[model samples]
Target: MTNITAGDVIFLIFCFSLAAYGYGVIHYGKKHSEEEKK
Candidate 1:
């Protein structure tokens, strides 16, 4: 089995959270804009 270090885990979490936050922002913005238009 391959051993993953603490640094690797932290980096993975950081990247994942960053991507998730960006996705959420984009999704929320789109939704809000569409709601405003209606």
Candidate 2:
């Protein structure tokens, strides 16, 4: 019981941050090409 309380929260936050960063990169990539054409 003690193990679950200490470790799980840290792991979840780390994963969530990575997912957010990936989304931002994809959005920027899509927009950048459009600007270049103009």
Candidate 3:
């Protein structure tokens, strides 16, 4: 049970980091395009 809980925590962290990275890439792409338009 404890091992499963540890694995869950690690999986959650990995998911959150992946989400954050995706958001950063999307946000930067939008900003770059706006700057180019200006």
In order, what lDDT does every prediction score? 0.90, 0.79, 0.85
lDDT of 2: 0.79
Candidate 3 lDDT over residue span 1-38, tens digit each: 35568889899999999999999979987878766644
TM-score of every model? 0.75, 0.58, 0.63
Highest lDDT: which candidate?
1
Off by over 4 Å in 3: 1-4, 33-38
lDDT of 1 by residue, 1-38 (tens): 79999999999999999999999989987878756644
Best to worst by TM-score, what's the order? 1, 3, 2
Residues 1-38, model 2: lDDT tens digits: 45565468888888999899999878887978766653
Residues forming the 10-long window of minimal summed lDDT in candidate 1: 29-38
Candidate 2: residue 30 lDDT (0-100): 91
- Using TM-score as the measure, name the better of candidate 1 and candidate 3: 1
Task: State which candidate, 1 or 3, has the greater lDDT.
Answer: 1
* Candidate 1: residue 3 Cα off by (Å): 1.4
TM-score of 3: 0.63
Model 2 clash number: 0
List the candidate 1 regions with Cα displacement exceeding 4 Å.
33-38
